[model samples]
Target: MRDFDFHPDEATVRCFAYPASGTVVNDESMWVGQTRQASPYDTMTEDLVLRHFALADEWFKLNATFDLRGILIQPGPPETSFAINCDIATPMVRVGEDVSAVDLFLDVLVRTDGTHRVVDNDEFEQAIGDGLLSTVEARRAEEGLVRLLGWVESGRLASLVHDYALDTVGQAPHPLPVEHWDVENVPSVAPGTRPTWHHG
Candidate 1:
């Protein structure tokens, strides 16, 4: 699980965890990371390249995947390439040396042909009803969703992805070796809390 800081209010920051793996690139305006997924189908051998983008104040996390192996069986067209997660959070901030971001749940699946679908609305609404998310947070999430859709409809997302992909080529190793990750021992940290891991 990837660790993040979830701010419910000005005075509270909760530790939020999500399943993901990648080597992160912290750019001036965004963070780009890439991970590899093995083909789920026994007959396929090629791996899928999943790229993640976290832009400043974008309110959404954009993921573009190159599924060369056709391993992912989703209800979309022949190939779906992008997924956007709308969230209510600030841009990633550095607490000493560790970097993390908050995640509020809502998603959009964009097919290769530019067609797309919004998903996880029920989950977002449920969070609001359960008091897991505030009304203001809900509004921010909705606004983020709208902005994300605009990026899709305007073809700006495609351009952004293409440029970022080019910028990341050979920048880092893909599919970060899990053998080197010690997530179980990684302590949870709140905003202003110093990371316990030593940088040696």
Candidate 2:
């Protein structure tokens, strides 16, 4: 804890802004270890839900996530199925002492059907052009992206995901817990907005 520069007196929810495809995808949630899982919220039509895990070792930290929307985690051809994905290390910044935000750059989306695609290249390029990220940082992200892609092609990424979740799923700590609620009842604000939720 001493080495960690940012420390909060209590758990604070932060809004993470993600510009994906053509629009900005915002998730407001609390930090759980190195990850943040957004609270279930309603958008214009459907619901948006996600869980992200940033795992670290001595060399580098890799990010993996289960991103889903709508009601159930339907199987098979995936009509709103579970997407288990890994990507380059998400670059983040501390908004305050308690809250942090990260950029999901060049993520490799690996689905349950053993199919894959690389996404968010335009967003990553935009980040670099806008001076949101430096050349070195961009290079690091690119390198990480390549490494993750190689893992995916070699079947190592799936193995890593299985091993990681199997070992840590039940053991990892949850710093903030969302109260049980239906989709309509879940807290929601405007798009790209981070709601202020304090846990004492």
Candidate 3:
């Protein structure tokens, strides 16, 4: 443990600001290794973004989940009737637990760490987890590029991914990752606001 020197003003400053980076879309799938590969910061290609949709679909159909909370696995979620899916969420990104095999609702599920738009002590650790998850996402973003780059470089992804981006689209519906919630430098989603600059 570190030592504590809690004078009034110092303690006050510490209380308000947490040990953190600005929040943004943080999914573990974006990160790779110990580094934050691709972030909303890096440039993204249409195909690179599209592949993530494919990966998320494959993983969902196979019931594969990469929970950021670590090694926990999801037992099969309660199956929903094939005829009744109206109760599911709207803009209904990915279908939650409930549906027949052929009845899977495959759509683009955009997970934004929108919750990070504002900070709170309740999910501070979760925020850090989102940042780390960037490594997973960045890799996903450039999985193909990395593969190609790997072929060009030492012939391996284990080699040339010193920097990657972690902004992947998913089909799973779970609690938002840390980075998704914060939007310090991002643009506004206000009325008449069109998506001008595509960062991630």
Using lDDT, give the best candidate's number.
1
Off by over 4 Å in 2: 1-52, 57-82, 90-104, 165-200
CA displacement after TM-score superposition, residue 119 of candidate 2 (Å): 1.0
Q: After superposition, how far is residue 101 of candidate 1 from its true place, in Å?
A: 2.3
On lDDT, the stronger of 1 and 3 is: 1
Q: How many backbone clashes does candidate 2 have?
A: 0
Clashing pairs in 2: none
Supply the TM-score for candidate 3. 0.17
lDDT of 2 by residue, 1-200 (tens): 00011111112223333322111112232222322234343332222233343333211133444323222121224444335545454333224332232333565666655577777788778766865554555676777677767776888766654442332332222234332222222222111221211110
lDDT of 1 by residue, 1-200 (tens): 33245433324444332234344556556766666566455554656556667665566776665554322223223444334433444345554434555456677877656678887778777766866554555677788788889988999877776664444433323453332222232223232232211110
Reference-based lDDT, residue 124, model 3: 27
lDDT of each: 0.54, 0.39, 0.20
In model 1, what lDDT does residue 56 have? 58
Q: Candidate 2: deviation at residue 161, Å?
A: 1.5
Residue 150 of model 3, lDDT score: 36
TM-score of 2: 0.47
How close to the true structure is residue 43 of candidate 1, measured as C-alpha lDDT? Answer: 51
